[model samples]
Every structure is written in C-alpha cells, then in structure tokens.
Target: MIGAATFFDGYTVIAIAYAMPVLAKEWSLTPGQIGLILSAGYLGQLFGALFFGWLAERIGRMKVLTFTILLFVAMDVACLFASGAVAMMAFRFIQGIGTGGEVPVASAYVNELIGSKKRGRFFLLYEVMFLLGLVGAGIIGYFLVPVYGWKVMFAVGLVPAALLIPLRFFLFESPRWLASKGRVEEADRIVSRLEQSVIKSGKTLAPVVEMPMAARPNAAQGWRELFKGMYFKRSLVIWAMWFGSYMVANGLITWLPTLYRQHFHLPLETSLAYGFMTSAAGVVAAVICALLIDKVGRRRWYIGALFCAAIPLGLLAATGATTPLQILMMAGLGYAMLQTVTFSLYLYSAELFPTRLRALGTGIGSAWLRLGSAMGPLVVGVAISGAGVHYVFGTFAIVLLITGCITALFAIETKGRVLEELSP
Candidate 1:
C-alpha cells in the first residue's frame, strides 16, 4: 500500500512533463512557457515537503500520507478543468504538494519498519516502485496522449484517490513513530502482531538485541533540531545530494521527450518511445543497484555511481548529441546512475536522522530535491536556448562531479548497522 501510494506520487510528478509536447502544440506555448509548467509542480513540491514533513513529525506519518494523496488527486481532477497554461500551472503546483509530501514521510515509515541489516534492499525494493511510476507515466503518455489526448493523462491520477479508503484501513501508523510519541504499549502491540504473522508463515524470528542508543528521545522534536548539534553536517550533505541528483535526473527525464520532439523534430510516437526507453534503462539500473547496494556499501556505491554518471554526460557534452540514438544512450546511462542514487538517498536520508526528526529531515532534504527538480527544466530551457543542447549536458556533468566530491568526502557508511546506533 505504501509503495502504491508512492507510485502515485511518482506518476503525478512526471505525468505533466510527459504530456508537455502535445500540450505545447495545442496551447501554442513557447519553450519558456513549457518549462514554467514543468517547474510548477516541483515548486509546489518544495512547499509540500517542508510542510508535510513538519506535519508528519507532529501528527504522524500515516495521517499526512493520507492527506497528501487526497490533495494531489483533487488537484489532478482540477487539471482536467484547466483551459489554459496558467490554469494548468495552478492545478499542477497544488498537485505537487500532495506528491511531494507523501514520499519523505513514506520513506521514513518504510525505513522505521525494517531492521538495518536488510534496510537498503528492502526499502529500495519499495522505492523502485516510484521509478516504476515514472516509467508507467511514460508508458501511459506514449499510448494515451497521442490517441486520447492530455485530459486522459490527468485522469490516470484519479485511481489513487479511490485508494484512500482502503489505505486508511489497511495501513497502520509507524511503530517507531508510536514509540517516539511515548505510546510504547501501542508500538509493542503492532510489532508483536507483525512477529506473529511472520511465525505463522513458517519463519523463525531473529533474536532481539538492544543497542546503546535504543532509548527514545523527546517526542517534541522541532525543525530546529535538524540543523542543530549532531544533525548539522548530515542535514547539509543529504540536502546537497538530493539537490544535485534530482536537478539532473528530473531535468533530463522530464524534458527528454519534449526536447526530442520539439528540438530534434522526431515523430511524436518515436519521441515518446525513446522517453519510455530511457525510463526502462533507469528501471534496469535500479534493480541492479537494489541487488548490489547492501554489498557495495552506501558511501562507496554513491561515490562510484555519481562519477560514473558524470563521465557519460561529460563525453556527450564534448562530442555533442549529433544522433538521437547517441543522446539516448548517453543520457540513459547517466539517468540510470542518477536513478540509483535518487532512490537510495531516501534510505540514506532516513538513516541519518533519529526517529523523532526522520520525516522532517527527509522532507527538508527532499525540498532540495524539489528545488533542483524545478530548476532543472528551467535551466535546460535556458541552456538550450542560450548555449545549445550540448551545454545542458555539460552543466549536468559538472553538477554530478561536485556532488560526487561531496559524497566521497562527507558521506558515512551505514550498511550493516542498526538505525538507532547510526542516528541516535
């Protein structure tokens, strides 16, 4: 259910971008106008992450998750009624809040549910659904927009709103959250129920062990705590990772089809197909990363992946994207590496903060994600118009290099360690 909710969130973020080429032709929009429309949802996401992240810390994850899903769905419906770019932008920005708010809290919820030993693999398997959502949007747009039109794209979002009723009944609040709120008895009941279900399925439970920092901290953890004392550096580094990764990932993925059609003058079907292929490449990379990440170690895996992604973009920048296949091959590889880092960062972000501030920290860090995501398209637009397409990849290459340095120098290894021990 959590994965499903997040999948919707992922779909909401990218669906409009997929629809952009068609919308631009119908609405007679300039590249600047299209870029604004693309950035609006991400801008809204920045507010949603900061707001919902804070709300989750207070009211709890499940409630915030429920609210965000409903809010975005309502906005999706609103988009269908939009008659122009301004109206569509309005609907998308509000919708962005719902999508943005859900993921960080959801990340915290999933992270809290798993033990650290399997944390990377388990959480990433779930996180992969978000990428699948992106791919799903591309697939849907490829078929639907050219045939049925753009309204059908927003209509796809309505499916999750129907999910809200079942989500409330089927999902429980986080146990770590329950414990942090000092409802230890309630937390124990939930954990005990999970254990019973595991045993009922013919698996023996592992022996429980307590860590030195197992005791819960104060429940009333405010936003200030994210930047205070022990959290300061972690907060800064994770924010940089989120910002740098999304700026490239979302910028490239969201704008690829539109750029392919508008600039390269490919047929609509062919452009959308290429976009779908790019998403497929990322999905394949995500599976590989999920399988090997626990063994590779988070710090080393990130350092290597970031640099690997940069190399292709750097080569593309120098050589130029002369052929459509060449651009797809190079951008697809970089996006694959970026997707690995993008999904893994949630696990990394959640692990860095304690139970009290986990959602908020993740949210704030994700706000940078929104910031970068928003800026990416705008930057791509300006770069394409002013400096040409090659410069856009060149800018991404540099951003990846700086991000790689940050991860190499500052990131800590969290593999095979308990969450409480790592964060607390």
Candidate 2:
C-alpha cells in the first residue's frame, strides 16, 4: 500500500516536468518562470518533510500517510484547473507537501518492519516503485501530452486517492514505533498477528532471539536530538548525501524535457521520449543497486555511485553539451548514477537513527533533499541563461566530487546490520 502511494507520489511529482514543455509554449514562460514553477513544489516539499515527519513521530505513520495522500490528491485535482504559471505554481506547492511527507515516513515505517538480512535489497525493491512512477509519468506524457494535453497529467494523478481506502482499513501502524513509545503490548499484538499469518502459510518460524534495546530518546526533544551525540555526524553526512544527489538528479530530470523542446527544437514527442528514456535508465540502475547493494555495503556503494556520476557530468561539461544526442546520452548516464544514490538514501538515513528519531530524522534530512531539489531547477535556469548548458553539467560534476569525498571519509556501513544495533 505504501509502495502504491509512493508510485503516485512519484508520478505526481514528475508529472509537472512532463507538462512543462506544453505549458511553457502555451504560457510563453521565461526560463526563470519555469524554474520558479518547478522549484515551488520542492520548496513546499521542504516544509512538508519537516511538518509531516514531526507529526508522524507523534500521531503514528498510518494516519499521517492517509492525510498526505488526501492532501496531494485534492491539490492534483486543483492543478487540472490551473491556467497560468502562478496558479500552477500555487497548486503544485500545496501538492508537494503531501508527496514530500509520504516518502521518508514510509521509508522509516518499512525499514522498521524487516530484519537485517537482505534488508538493503528488500527496501530498495520497494523504493523502485517511486522510480517506476517517474517512468510512468514520462510514458503518459509521451503519448498523452501531445494528444490529451497537460491537464491529463494532473488528471491521472487522481488515481492514488483510491489507495486511501486500503491504507486506512487494511494497514497497521509500525510496531517498532509502538515499541519505541513503550507501548510494548500493542507492538507485540501487531507482531503476533504477522507471525500468525506467516505460520498459516505453512512456513516454520525461527525461534525468537533477544536483541539489544535501542535507546528511546525523548520524542519531544524532536529535531534538537539530531544535533547531539552520535547522530550529529550521521545527520550531517546523510544531509550532504541527500542534498548533493538530489540537486543533480532532480535538476536533470525535471528540466530535460523542456530543455530538449525549447533549446534543441525537438518535437514534443521526441522531447518527452528522451526524458522518458532517462527516467527508464535510472530505473534500471536503481534495480541493479537493489540487487547488489547489500554485498557492496552502503558507504562504498554511495561513494562509488557519486564518483562514477561525476565522470560523465565532468566530461559533458569539458566536451560542451552541444548536441541533443550528446546531452541525452551523457546527462542521462549521470542522472542514472545519481539516481541510485537518491533512491536509496531513505534506507541509509533511517538506519542512522533509532526508532524514536527515525522518521523525524529522515524527514529533516530529506528537507535538504527538498532544498537541493528546489535549487537544482533554479540553478539550471540561471546557468542556462548565463553560462550555457555545458556549465550546468560542470556545476553538477563539482558537487558530486565533493560529496563523494565526504562519503569516503565519514560514512559508516550499515548493510546486514540490524537497525537497533546499527543506530544504538
């Protein structure tokens, strides 16, 4: 259910990127205006991550997830009615709150459910739905945008509202969250129910092993705790990872369609097709990461991914991003490399803190994600207007290089380590 919700979240978030080409032509939007419209959603996402992350830690994940889904769905409908840049920006900003809030909290919730064995693979496989959602938006945009128009992008986003029913009625709150709150009995009840369901399928259960109790910090201290103790360094590292990866990844993904159409004079179909291909490449890279990250280890995988991405981006800048095919092939590869880092950071972030802080910490860390996401498009706008498109790739390559160095020096490996053991 969470995966399904995120699928729509992915679709709705990137759908605007697909719509931008037509909207730009129709509205005669300046590059700056286009950046503002794109940035608005991500800016809204920053607040949403903070507010909703804090709320989930208090009220529980399921309820907050429900509210977020409803919020974005309604705003998506509102987007269908938007007639200009200002109106679209306003609607997307409001809608971003919902999409932004859902992922990190959902990441925390899902992470808490599984054991250490194959945890990287399991969580990342779930994370792939969001990437698929990006591809879905691109596919929809490729076929539908030219015929049915931009409004159709917003219209298809409405489908996730139906997910609310299953979310509310069928899902239980995170048991690890309950246990952290000292509601041991309630947590045990939910766990027992899961165990019983597994036994009913004729699988024998392993004997329970006692694990070290994770520190339950005062939940009320909230965001302040992130800056104290072991978490302080962890927080900084993850935040840097989130910001650097997202800034480059989203900058490329969101602006590529419009850039192709406006800058290269490609037909609408070709532009959307190129964008979709980039997204598809990212999905493939992400799946490969999902399959192998556990053995490679988190710290090494991230450091390698970051450095690998820098190579293509740096080359693109050195060579000058002159041709459409050149931009697509080089930038697409760079985006795919960063995509692995961006998609898996939630798993890494949640592992960095205890349950008491997991959702909140992930939320706050992802706020940097929102900031980077917002900045990426704006930077692209400024770079294109001033230094030319090649300089955009040059800037991203520098960011990736710095981030890769930081990860190499400081990041800790979390693969196959139990959450409680890793953080505590």
Candidate 3:
C-alpha cells in the first residue's frame, strides 16, 4: 500500500510531463509555450511541498495525506473541462498543488514510520511504485492516445486515486511522530503494528532523539532550521544538483517523441510508442535501483549510475540520427540510465535537511527540479529554432553529465543511517 500510493503520487505527474508532446499538439503550442504551462504546475508543487511539510506537523500525517489526495482527484478530473490552452494551463497549475504535495508529505510520513537500517531500501521500494506508475502511463498512453486522443492521457490519472483510496484506509500514522509528541498510547499502538510487520529483521523502532515535535513550531522554525550553519551550504549544492539534472531529464523526456517525429520523420504512433519504450526503460531502471540501492549504498550508486548516463547523453548529441534504431538505442538508453538516481533524489534531498524543515528543505531544493523541468523545453525550443535539434539534445547531454558530477561531490550518504538520525 505504501509503495503503490507513494509511487502513483509521483508517476501521475511524471506521466503528464512525458505526455507533453501530445498535449502540445492538441493545443497547438510551441515548445517554450508548453514549457510555460508545465512550469505553472511545478510552481504550485514548490509551495505545496513546502507548506504541507508544516501542515503534517500540525494535523497528522494520515489525515493530511488523505485530504491532499482528494485535492488531486478533484483537480485532475476538472482538467477534462479545460476548454482551451489558457484553461488547460491554469487547471494544470492548480492540479500541481495536489500532485506535488502528495509525495513529499508521503515521503516524510513513510520514512518516519520505518526503522533506519532498512530506510534506504524502503524509499527505494516506494520509488519502484513511481516507476510502475510510469509503466502504467506508458501502457495507457501508448494504446489510449492513439485510439482516443490526448484527453484520455489525463483520464488515466484517476487510476491511482481509486487504488489509493481503499489501501490508505488500513494505514497508521508514524509512531516516531506520536512518540515525539508524548502521545504514548497512540504511539505504542502504531509502533507495535510496525514491529509486527517486521519478522526477519530484528531491528526495533526507536526515535533518533526523545525530543518532541508533533505540534506546530513558529514560522521562523522553517526559515531558521534550513539556513543554520552547514545546512545553508548543503542546501545550495543540493539545489544546484536537483535543478541541473532535472533540466536535462525534462527537456529530453518531454520532447523525445516530437524530436524523433519531426527531426527524424517517424510516424505518430511509432514515435509515441518509442517514447513509451524510452519511459519504460526509466521504470525498469528505477525499480532495479530501488531494489539494489540499500545493498550498494546511496552514494556509490548515484555517482556511478548518473555518470554513466552522462556518456550516452553526450553521444546522442554528437551523432546524427542515421537510423530509427540508432536514435532509440541512444536516446532511450540515455533516459533509462538517468532514472538510477531519479527516485534517490527525493529520498536524498528530503534527508539532506532536518525534520522540522524536511518539507521546507525538500520544497526549496525541489523548486529547482521544477525550474529545471520548466527550462528544459524552453531551451530546446530556442536551440531547435536557432541552432538546430542536434544542438538542443547535445546541450541536454552536457548538462546531465554536469549534474551527475555535482550530485556525487555534494550529496551525503543516507543508506545505513536511521531516518531519525538524519538531520535533513
């Protein structure tokens, strides 16, 4: 249940990000114009992740999660009525608020509930759902978009809501959170269930500190917690990595099919299917990484995997497309390689900052994710319009290599550490 819900929350939005090429066609939008619309959703997501962090502190994780998902269901359904480009963009932004808040809130909530030694693998499993959602999106979009039209792509967003609604009913709140607040009875009940959920693992549930933080803190708590000492420096570097890497990802994923279609002159069905295949690679890779992340450790995998991703990206830029198979092998494989750290970033970034500011920390850092995603297509649009499509893709490759290095140098290792011990 945790895995599926957490994943759907991310995959639902990501599917839309991947489907931008088709959406642009229906609306007759230019690449930069499409980027602008996507940014609106991200802008909302930035705030949602930040604010909801605190909201969970005040209200309980389970209740807030329930409400937040309802927001996703309502707004995503409303998108069907979006009459034109302006309406579509506006609704999309509103929808972002719900979609964006769901994952960060869930991430914090889920992590707080699980024990430390297994935390890395747990988050990785959560990420596997994210990949599954992409597979769901790919399968749906590959078949539905061709037969029905782009609107059906958004309709598929409802599937998570249906699946999540029933499963979440059986969920319990984080005992770490309850214990911190001195809710001894409630906390004990939750912890016992969590303890039982584990059979082979002998690890006991323990909070990092005995300190209480269940209720709301001052506004200064968020602002001050993030900037104090080493935190400020860590924030800057992590944000840079998140921003730069995602810029490359969004630019490529959003435009890959269209680039293949227009630049390579492939058929629409063929291009969309190719895009689905490329996205499927990301799903497979993300799942594999999720399974292996704990064993390999976070630091080693992120550094090696993303660096490997950089090479193919660089090649795709330098090569001229001699054949469809060649383009798919390069562009598709490049995207697959990048997913190695895609799920890790959510886990890593949230872990980078302290709990009081976890949501805020993730919000501020992830803003760059949106910023990167927003800029990716706009830059591609410019390069395509001016220099050429080759230049756009080539530039994307360079940026990704740079992002991989930056993440390796700066982001801390969180594999063995208990979630409670994590300051960020």
TM-score for candidate 1, please give it: 0.98
Query: Any residue pairs clashing in model 2, and if so which?
Result: none
State residue 402's C-alpha deviation in candidate 3, in Å: 2.9
Q: Judge candidate 1 at residue 16 and give its lDDT.
A: 90
Q: How far is candidate 3 from the true structure (C-alpha RMSD, Å)?
A: 3.5
lDDT of 1 at 19: 84
Once fitted onto the true fold, the runs of candidate 1 whose alpha carbons sit more than 4 angstroms away are: 213-221
Q: Write the per-residue lDDT of candidate 3 for residues 1-424, one digit (tens) a residue.
A: 7677666666556566546656766778876676676666766676666666667766667887887787877777877777677786787777777766777777777666656677777777777776777667767767777688777867877776788788787988877567555688998987676567664487655553454433444545656756766687778777777777777776777667777676677877788788778888888888788778888887788778777877776776678555667768887787787777666687887677655566556666776776777787778778877787667667877787777777677767777775545662
Instruction: Give, for candidate 3, the lowest lDDT window spanning 10 residues.
Output: 208-217
- Return the lDDT, model 3, position 229: 68
lDDT (C-alpha, whole model) for all candidates: 0.91, 0.93, 0.71
Over 1-424, each residue of candidate 1 has an lDDT whose tens digit, in order, gives 9899888888888899778888999999988989999999999999999999999988999899888988998998999999999999899999999889999999999999998788889989999999899889989999999999888889998998787657678888899999888799999999999999999999999999877755554445488777787799999999999999999999999999998999999999999999999998999999898989999999999999999999999988999877788999999999998899998899999999998889999999999999999999999999888888999999999999999999998999999888888888
How many clashes show up per model?
0, 0, 4
Which scores better on TM-score, 1 or 2?
2
- Models 1 onward score TM values of 0.98, 0.98, 0.88
* C-alpha root-mean-square deviation, candidate 2: 1.0
